[model samples]
Target: TQLLEQSPQFLSIQEGENLTVYCNSSSVFSSLQWYRQEPGEGPVLLVTVVTGGEVKKLKRLTFQFGDARKDSSLHITAAQPGDTGLYLCAGPTNTGNQFYFGTGTSLTVIP
Candidate 1:
């Protein structure tokens, strides 16, 4: 079974702070995606990494895929109140009919 687990189930930070969240799994994935979601809205894709050791940066956010393809990371710099939301990491399951979402990391950035 392929499963992804995220750490620090919740985080609260003041504006301008920085933080990192982790996603790990025992199974390898062909590709992994990071998404940020706001209340009552579907998750928006932040990035996708298909190669080991791949790194992609979007503004103040950075994402990395593990060399083994079994882990990933998300780093936020100079966080703002707008960054408050749920961050999720997901990958297509072996069956290909489902996407496995991580435990989820909820971040709150206070102004």
Candidate 2:
């Protein structure tokens, strides 16, 4: 079963553009993590949003956790070619026993 669903599975944009991708799930989670994976490499953790309705910013990237703690969004500002990669959101099950990863959003930032 798919625990997490990510919107806009495929995205292609020009440099200096902005974009937002979403991750949603029915079950509530205590915390959620966002990751970015480049071609032929492992995913690197971007940030972990723990509290409900929390917003975190890393450079030009922004992450927001839903007020209900069941959804999240990632927004990128001033996209660059170096930003091209797959963005994935992951979280633990309600019981905190297992983890689930979103289907992912593929981002292509053309120079």
Candidate 3:
């Protein structure tokens, strides 16, 4: 089974600061998705990338897929305290429709 991996497992930054998080995998997926999760709520999908080198922006956040389609990144410009949450990247596995999630990144944006 293939697995997704994330870097900088934990991040703490002050408000108005910028930060970047990464997700990587050796296996290529049909599509990759990014999610933001709060303490007690299910993850909310932020963006999905299906094409290699595709880039998407939402407000102050930018999402990018690697040219090889085996990696992804999220960058936040002037992060706010409300942005604190767990970031996850997920993609379907080789077998069936099962999806695998990355080793999550915990972000704490201090006000």
Candidate 4:
């Protein structure tokens, strides 16, 4: 079953602007992870927000998990061209044997 959904499948913004991408699901997760994939390399883990209502920042990128642990958001401030990539969120299945990933949001930042 499709467990995770991400919004705005695609996004393009000018440099220095801010943007937010969302990930939602009907099921609650024990922990949620965000990843960013560049052109060729594999998706790199950005952050893992475990607790509901928790927020974490990685430089200009900010990540937050919903209070119910069923949603999450990634916000970037003063977005730069280097931030262009495909953002994805993943959560382990109830069985804890595998992970379900979001559809993905491809972001392009114009310089």
TM per candidate comes to 0.94, 0.96, 0.94, 0.96
Candidate 4 residue lDDT tens string, 7-37: 8899999999999999999999999999999
In candidate 1, residue 27 scores what lDDT? 90
Root-mean-square deviation (CA) per prediction = 1.5, 1.0, 1.5, 0.9
Angstrom error of the Cα, residue 106, model 2: value is 0.3
Residue 29 error for model 3, in Å?
1.3
Model 4 alpha-carbon miss at residue 108, Å = 0.1
**Residue 5 accuracy (lDDT) in model 4:** 94
What tens digits encode model 1's per-residue C-alpha lDDT throughout 8-100?
899999999999999999999988999999999999999999999999999999999999999999999999999999999999977878899
Score candidate 3 by lDDT: 0.93
Better of 3 and 4 by TM-score: 4
Which residue pairs overlap in candidate 2's backbone? none
lDDT by residue for model 3 (1-111), tens: 438999889999999999999999998888889999999999999999889999999999999999999999999999999999999999977673888999999999999
Where model 3 places Cα greater than 4 Å from the true spot, the runs are none
TM-score of 2: 0.96
Single out the weakest 10-residue window by summed lDDT for candidate 1.
1-10
Which consecutive 10 residues in model 4 have the weakest lDDT in total?
A: 1-10
